[model samples]
Target: MLVDSHCHLDFPDFAEELDAVVDRARQAGVGRMVTICTYLSRFDRILAVAERYDDVLCSLGVHPHQAAEEIGGVTVERLVELSRHPKVIGLGETGLDYFYDKSPRDIQQECFRRHIRASVETGLPLIIHTRDADDDTMRIVREEAAGQPVKGLLHCFSSGRQLAEDALDFGFSLSLSGIVTFKKSEELRDIVRDVPLDRILVETDAPYLAPVPFRGKRNEPAYVAHTAACVAEVKGVDAAELARRTTENFFRLFDRADPSRQAAA
Candidate 1:
């Protein structure tokens, strides 16, 4: 079964047909999904979604876009406390986003560092989002990871080769989103071609960036298969094998969300 390692299921885009959306994902062979929390204030909504679905899990932390708004109230102690929840498997959709500059760069860096520290304390994987700020992102991550190994996924990765190499060297996995299926992502495809399959994961980042066939339309967990298919072609592996390996990679990295534990229960 394929796992959508990153998505925003609590977004309003899925509110009216949340059940149907999830059912479609199951029918499409996506067995699991991790909805992301972009705002600490709205974390309750994200947690509620995860709690309502056995196959759904979540990450807790602020997105870099909301850093300026949430930073005043966010604390490593608080993030750690909330992350104690059984359904929260990872931390942060947090990282630098220079592309939009939605939040002050310094604030974003600080927020990112706090999430990294939380991940270290909780031993949970971090779900990172970096766009147009590869250097600072890698710099901060490397500095914080000094002597303390940090495990995480670079979600919706469409960055340059240097960032990819830096991230892999830091022992973090790269998650491919629908953007990899776009026509202009040749550089990204080339980067994936060189990446070890074991370190690759696929996601839709839905409610956005749908794959080629579904491009320009609202995305959902079900479309992760299309992203997986593109990655398989890029890696020259069978699509099923790609799915299996990425699913394995997901569980291996996010060890707290154990499928075996679910089955046993």
Candidate 2:
């Protein structure tokens, strides 16, 4: 079975059809999903979603885009505190995003560092979101990880091969999103082909970036199969094997998520 390692089920896009969305995911062989909390203030809503669905786990942190708004509130202490929940499996869909510049670069870096510290303290793998800031992202992850060994996954990775190589060197996993299925993502597909299967994971980042044939449409966890199939084809492996390997990789990186818990669900 496949696992959608990152998604935002709390988003209003799925509000009325969450049950149906999840059912579709199950029917598509997506046995589990991890809903991401982009803003700490709305964590209760995110947590409530996780509590409602046994197969849906979650992460906590402030997205880089919202860093300025969460200043003084996105503390390592607060992140560690919220992460104590049994279903909170990771930290920070957080990292640099120079593409949007939604928040000042410095503030985003500071917030990213705090989340990394929280991940180190909590022993939860960090869920990173990076775009057009590979140098800074790499430097911060490498610097902070040097002080304290940390585990993390580069979520929705669509960066340069050098960044992918650097992150892998730091012992981090790369999660592929529906973007990789786009026809223009030849570079990304090349990166996927080179990445070791054991260090790969799959996600939909649903309500956005739906895979091919479903492009320009609202994405859901069920569509992870298409992304997985694309990655599998690029890697010269069968879809089922890719699912098994990515599921294993998911559990390995997000160790806080219990496999038995999914079975029980």
**Per-model TM-score versus the true fold:** 0.98, 0.97
Q: Best candidate per TM-score, number?
A: 1
Question: Residue 217, candidate 1: how far off, in angstroms?
Answer: 0.2
Give the clashing residue pairs of candidate 1, or none: none
Clashes of 2: 0
In candidate 2, what are the lDDT values of residues 1-265, reduced to their tens digit?
9999989999999999999999999999998999998999999999999999988999999899999998679888898898999989999889989999999999999999999989888899999999999999989987887768899989999988999999999889999999999999999999988999999999999989999989999999999999999999999999989999999888888877866655786
RMSD of each: 1.2, 1.8
Which ranges in model 1 have alpha carbons more than 4 Å from their true place? 261-265
TM-score of model number 2? 0.97
* Lowest lDDT 10-residue stretch of candidate 2: 256-265
**Candidate 1 structure quality by residue, lDDT tens digits, 1-265:** 9999999999999999999999999999999999999999999999999999999999999999999999987898999999999999999898999999999999999999999888888888888999999889888887887779789989999999999999999899999999999999999999999999999999999999999999999999999999999999999999999999999999999988877866776
